[model samples]
Target: MDFSFSDEQRMVQDSMRAFARAELLPKYTHWDRNDEFPREQWLKMGALGVLGLRVPVDQGGQEADCVTAGLVIEEIARGDFNCCYGILNSCFAGDILGKFASPAVKDTWLPAMASGETVLCVCLTEPHCGSDAAAIRTQAVRRGDSYVLNGEKSGVTLLMVGDAAIVFAKTDPAAGAKGVSAFLVPLDRPGITRHPYSDMGARGIVRGSLFLEDVEVPAGNLIGPENGGFSRVMQTFDYTRALIGLMCLGAAQATVEETVDYLKQRQAFGRPLSTNQGVSFPLAEWSAKMEMARWFCYRTLWLRDQGLPHTRESAMCKMQVPVIAADAVHDCLILHGHYGYTKDFPVEQRLRDVIGQEIADGTPHIMKIIVARDLFGRDFV
Candidate 1:
């Protein structure tokens, strides 16, 4: 199989890289320091066709394939890891809305989201559930023409800034995953409240808790078949996990590149640090591992585009990439000596940011379970 990127893919990567360098790199530190979301930059990215990559062209998106979407995400993360979370949410949520939402809901939200006029967040994890999505406790009870939602969603990305959310809740409390449903709830509703988290990294994209108390949502906002919504939404993660891997890899790649340059120039023991076998060998090893992980991400995306079964591959990407990236960033930090420990260099921040990815989307343990279950029968695994 040919492993090369097409000209169009190369163009997408280059364009996104240029945009990140011009728009994100300069302000990344400021955003990190102030814990400020770059709302303006998000808007600019929307104008650049970055926000709606997964949505079809008719729906105000670029109609890019999964591989191209991953490239855009990776490039953006290279400049500011926090910003990629917004991109991920926009692409993931937009794709879901485009496919499952009613035409009116699509017409209303897709354009606004594509243009960055609105922010969208996904509410899945509840206070009691993290990786085990089937155990979510949030409830959406039907009431004539609407659904009354009452529960708390924790660790919701972009909740503070989001205009709306795609929430998953249990419609049939007695049933397990099959009884779950999804809804597109507008955050302006009276019964919704948000509390932000002061996280160690990715501060620009605030992680928060969303509380719903008798939040009434119109029946028209239901995303898909009531009980079937759980399975449908879970499928989206097969695509998103690879993108998340790429995002983390991008940040780590940037850190590695910076360290390589630093080692070439910094003298130690009467020679450049790169001349030492200790420094060079480990960096070489990490470089190799990172390259392998990068290709794994792209290949998984390509398989998704080909309409192949990629759940196991996607799980592998998500499971391994973040850990690899964390190691790369950590090694790069140690190689930088005292300078890396300070906030003066971006390595420290990259380290914190990439570490969080190990837990984001899905943890390594969860991913391993997925891969194992796929390889062995569920009963055996």
Candidate 2:
């Protein structure tokens, strides 16, 4: 198997890395502190083809493949770990609409999203059910030409600033997993309310809780088939989980890179801290793990573009990158000694932010369960 990036892919990685370092790094803390979502950054990245990478050119996108999309994500992450919020906002909702919605729906949403005029959030996780998606309690009842959605979806990224949400709800609660359905619901409606989520990290992310109390959506808003939404919801993870891996992969890379810089600059016993094997060896180990995790993520994307089943691979990547990232960040933090534990140094924030990735896409335990199910049997889960 050839493991080289094409000219276009190499250019994508290099260009996005440059852009992210320039735009995202300087303001990472400011956005986190001020609760600011960069609308202008969205427009800028859209101009750079960072948004809607997979949509057709006629629909105002770059018309790229899944591999190109994954490369863009990985590069964005390499610069600013929190940039994954933008990636998921653009790709997850957009890809789902492109694959499952009608032409009219495509004609309406894709153009604006591609141009960065609108941003979308996915509302699927509820307070009661997270990784166990089939156990959701939000119900949407069909009325005459309309569906009244009444449920709360928690942990929705960027819901506080988004224009719309691609939400999942139970249309036939009795049918269990087959009962779920997807809908594109506008956030400006009467019954929709957004509340900010107070969390330890992801200060750069605009996490929010969505309450849809009798939110009436047009029947035309239904995104896929009536009762077949569960599969679509599951499929949405195919785009996001690996990107989450890339996000943590970026954080892991940042941890090592920053620590290496600190070791060179900081003198210990009248010598550079990195000169000692005690410091150098562990950093080397973290670097090794990070490099392996990075390739695992990209290779999974390659397989995905090849139309292979990547569920098991994604789970493993997601599982491994966080452990690597969390360990690397914390280990590097310890290398910094006192400064690492302080917020002023930013390593602490990197540590805090990387911790969230372990639970976000799927819990570490959930990923392990997926791996077990794949290796042993489906009944293992």
Candidate 3:
């Protein structure tokens, strides 16, 4: 496959980089310190067509390919890792709505989401089930023209400010994964409770628990065929995992650049620290890894665009990129000395932020399971 980015893709990447440098990087620290979501910047991204990367143009999105979406996310993450969630959620949730929701629902919600007037969060993980999403116990029972939802979703991103959520719950308890279904629930509805987490990183975007106690969702909000959402939701991960990898790489790339610059300027025994093999070698290694990972991520996205099976590639990208990013950021922090350990510097925050990616989407262990299942066949594994 050709690896070169097209002219349009190059323009999209350049535009995102410029926006990040001028708008996001300057204020990311303030948002992190105050635990504030930069809603204004999110709106700016929407206005710039960044939030609507995957949504069809007729639905107020750019109708861009998956690789373009990944490029936009990588650039944004470079400026503020937390803000990349805006893109992730928009694309993930929007894709579902665009594909399965009724025309009315799509017209009503997708445009708002595309314009940043509404934020969408996804609810899949329950209090007891995360990696084993098929084991989720959240129940949605049909009652008249609505489904009354009950149970809690943990580690839900953007819950505090989300206008709506694409919630997955068990519609038929006896069928295991086949029993699952998806619904678009409005967050303002009664019987919904949100409890935000005080997190180690990505503080600007709230991660929280969502409790739906007899929450009434209109029957019209059901997404996809009833009892058939598990496969659909799982398929979206092929796209999202690759984007997550790119996002982590963006953060890692930033830290590596900062460390390299510091090393070049930091004096040690009458010469630059960068000249020393001890200081430079590790940075060089990490830089190479990040570059390789970036290509891997884009390749996964390219596979999706070609309508090919990318489950293995996506799993590999998710498994490797975040770990590499976290290590790179950690080393960058150490290379900066005590100043990097303090909240005064961004490296410490980058380390914390990228570390969370190891758990997001799917853990390394889960990714390994996927890769193994593919390689050895499910029964043999």
Best by lDDT: 3
Q: After aligning candidate 1 to the native by TM-score, how far in Å is the CA of 56 from where it should be?
A: 2.3
Q: Model 2: clashing residue pairs?
A: none
Off by over 4 Å in 3: none
Candidate 1 lDDT by residue in tens digits, 96-210 = 8888899888888888888888999999998888999999899999999999999999998888889999999999988999999999999999999999999998888888999
State in Å the error of residue 143, model 3. 1.5
lDDT for predicted candidate 3 compared with the true structure: 0.91
Candidate with more favorable, higher TM-score: 1 or 2: 1
TM-score of 2: 0.96
In model 1, the runs with Cα more than 4 Å from the true position are none
RMSD (CA, Å), each prediction: 1.0, 1.5, 0.9
TM-score of each: 0.98, 0.96, 0.99
Model 3, residue 215: displacement in angstroms? 0.9
- Count of backbone clashes, every candidate in sequence: 0, 0, 0
